[model samples]
Target: MPSRSFVVLAEQAQARHDGRVQFRQVLIDAVKPAVDLVYPPRCPLCGTAIAQQKGLCAPCWSELIIPGEPCCTTCQRPFPADYSEAAMVCGPCMADPPRHDGIAAGTLYNHASRALVLSFKHGRRIALSRMLAPLIIAQLPQLEGEWLVVPVPLHWSRLWYRGFNQAALLAEHIAKATGQTLLVDGLRRTRRTQPLGGLGRKGRERMLSGSIRLHPRKSDVMKAAQVILVDDVLTSGATSDACVKALKRGGAKTVKIACFSRVLDEARGQNTAMPETKTPEA
Candidate 1:
């Protein structure tokens, strides 16, 4: 018979095979029940009870507007359902392309998405950043590449009034979830402009021109770096244009705008038409 001491030692050695025991899983097993008991997981979109974890309720999920192809390859502008594939560039972009390399956006800036952005932006629903960040991340094809995750900065005045920069929050979450290095204060809004909501394209661009610049301290890192620019909404594309110009001027090799929502420019509606070689979904 084996000695009791040796048998006991063998048992301890077997138990000490730590690879067989997952510490994270053990912690989750012990803690999740208590956390769930006290605070249930509610739907991020509607705050209703959900059968599953980490997403919107079915109705809310269905309401999200995801624009597919047959859109502008450059600006990702949405065209009518009958638009053809041959016509990818919008009139504005074709006439004079944007200064930035390209754009990627999560969804159309319809009523549902607008409400979400407003809730997160002005209503202090900061938790929505985690929920909405995946939308922007989905649009990034170079997410895993060597890149800087940069957020459009809010001016100090606006930051004081808003209490937080929504773009930075989104960028942080994107970095956390994707393991990307985030440049939290990469861009600084040097000059504040009036709200650009109602401004025409030219007016918005003019207002934002020379308004943003690369952080002096971060200039070295930005040199020749591919950048993923995060923002809450792509409105007139003027702010993005200015920021991209600044990024390139600061020596960023490539700048791609990624936003949770993109405003479909109505001015380009007629100009986005293509020949009948490829048709959009009606």
Candidate 2:
């Protein structure tokens, strides 16, 4: 059991965090008009000017595949309109059940979404976090129990090189929007692993094995709690699975994955050619 002092201290920390977030929002709101005027909004993909900031043009918007219902019950991979079943589990889920509760993906991996991800992540367009976070939030279900938002951790080397973890940015926005507790350091990457690009599911799993674990101080906070593991992209599911395993190992009751995009090669079938990992953003 946690002590009263611990609870109070936690509350204070959360209050401070909320205050900082609100301050940033206020600051952005204040200067956004001027910024918009200086650099008019344009479609992230095609560079076509748009009316609103952080929005897509009509053609680019059409290219994005926002996932909806008739999805796999276990994984939430969208199913075809004519696809129907009593269990509602996709073929992949049926063959090998997922360890996590389900996935909440904003869009299927497509050219338009790929460009946005590359721009936001690799191109250092941090402002795009605002645009991407909402897509992921729209896919999330209403919460019924206590839920903690946690980002998939990055190793020290990666953090130092990248300056910021893209997943953490998304997770922070999600926690703020959903009114959930954001445990920014809930999980920690134990060591640096090679990128998962060009790797098969088994190969990726092998690389991520024992690479992620719950933060020592976060065990109590995670115990019996429902956790939302956030990431920018869900490719092979290897990374998210490792994070979920760590959360459950730390006594979390349930873990769900929320991501900006998901690569559904199985759902899309052999006809659709997809990139192996797509910038190692998984």
Candidate 3:
């Protein structure tokens, strides 16, 4: 018979090896079940099951209007039918050139895209960022250089109330996809502003003016790096412009806007006028 001490040592060794084997098996079992149950994630836009991962279903993907030729060079907004692509400036960009050098958007802010954005931003569908980020990255193939991505910041009070920043979530995914550095603290909203959805172009511009500021320490990084400001939506381009202005003031060499959607002015059915701003009272 084995000595008692030798048997105890042998038993301890076997137990340790068994524990490691059991742990590995548990992990494999947990992951295997999930893998078997996996279907392509559903489209946030149409709720149709998508093939592969982080993508829209083929039909919905085909239906997506990737903004193409004849867009505004500076803003990436679709230009009027008669506008020339070589013009380099749309009427709005010429009239009031944004502080940013250019813009890139994943899709037109039309009915389908609007549904998706609203679901992700307000419905707490945080997983939608996984699909949205890849689409945005697909549109920005030329995105290279010493780039820093900064999300449009939400006020601390609003973030606390909402429990997340949709833009920040989107930015995180983009940073992960592109291997670009995310400078989350680069921009901030000093005051809470009313949602700009129903505001007229001018009203939206006024509301966002001077609302964003850059951190003092990141001025050196801003001076040295190109910046891409990420946001969930673009309406009247006011928020992006405000962010660009602040980044430029902090010495950013160039600033560009990248958003998931852009609201079209002409799409409002009969409600063409600006609605009253409903800011929360302090």
Candidate 4:
């Protein structure tokens, strides 16, 4: 019914409307609410809906104690308020120094931190590693000369049942982030020990003692190599100490630990870190 000229004008108006607005961007923005409705990013620590993935909401972050400066020179534990600023080994560590040269953890293990660690360690939430690896790496000082990133090894039998090693996953992400060479198999668990959860320090140590060793064929390469041990949690330092002992016995020059969380007997109310020589960072 319209004249050709009128028809042309109508088409032009439609084109102008389409061009004036970015339908792609508009559509993307419009669907975001729907998209968010279907899939929202939740905090890794708690299920609270957060703005982004791998987020620890403000409350959770505040509740969890992050390790910072003036840590122990040996064990890297935070000092009690009265003893802050003095860098010395806690009595517990001084009683018998850990075999590893040094140790550090991203956060003190507590009720607030336990949930996050358990969820990742047992809940099969591999995605949480993205958030956790950074925390572990943050505590590590740069090591001397081309250190090898070694994840605490899991016995093959346990690995078969679990389908994955949490420590190896952390080591993988850490190796990528730091561009360090990783030897996931540099150390192998000689035998499976009982889970360390219900064990005291001595029990744990006894269980893990003589349980780790370097790969027989890889021994030549690892000899004299500095080692960076990776693990999910540091409880009594027994397993780490055992690992360090094995490595040193196998000819590793030095070994240090970088773990995501630590379970210390803070109720004792004493200094927590240990004394050790500072390694020059490369």
Per-residue lDDT, model 2, residue 71, is 87
Which predicted model would earn the best lDDT?
2
Flag regions of model 1 displaced more than 4 Å: 1-41, 44-47, 79-87, 143-145, 267-282
**Local accuracy of candidate 3 as per-residue lDDT tens digits, 1-282:** 989999999999999999999999999877864664675456666777654335667776676667876777777768657776495667777887667787788887665676677677667778888878777777674766668989999888888877888888888988878889999888889888877857667897798877789987787788857888999877677777788889888888877787887666565543332221222322
Distance from true location, Cα of 245 in model 1, Å: 1.1
| 10 residues in a row with least lDDT, candidate 2 | 268-277
TM-scores, each model vs. reference: 0.77, 0.85, 0.77, 0.79
For residue 244, give model 1's deviation from the true position in Å: 0.6
For candidate 2, the TM-score is 0.85
Candidate 4 lDDT tens digits, 1-282: 889999999999999888767777788788887877888878777679898655688898898788876667888777765676565777767987778888768888766667776777667788888888998888888765788899999889878776788899999998889888989998899898766655567887788888898888778877898888999888777788888888888899889898888877663243332211110110
lDDT of 2 by residue, 129-177 (tens): 9989999999998888679999999998888887898999999999999
Using alpha carbons, what is the TM-score of model 4?
Answer: 0.79
Question: In model 2, which regions exceed 4 Å deviation?
Answer: 1-33, 84-86, 267-282
Pick by TM-score: which candidate is best?
2
All candidates' lDDT scores?
0.79, 0.88, 0.76, 0.78
- The number of residue pairs in model 1 that clash at the backbone is 1
Error of 3 at 30 (Å): 6.2
Better of 1 and 3 by lDDT: 1
User: What pairs collide in candidate 2?
Assistant: none
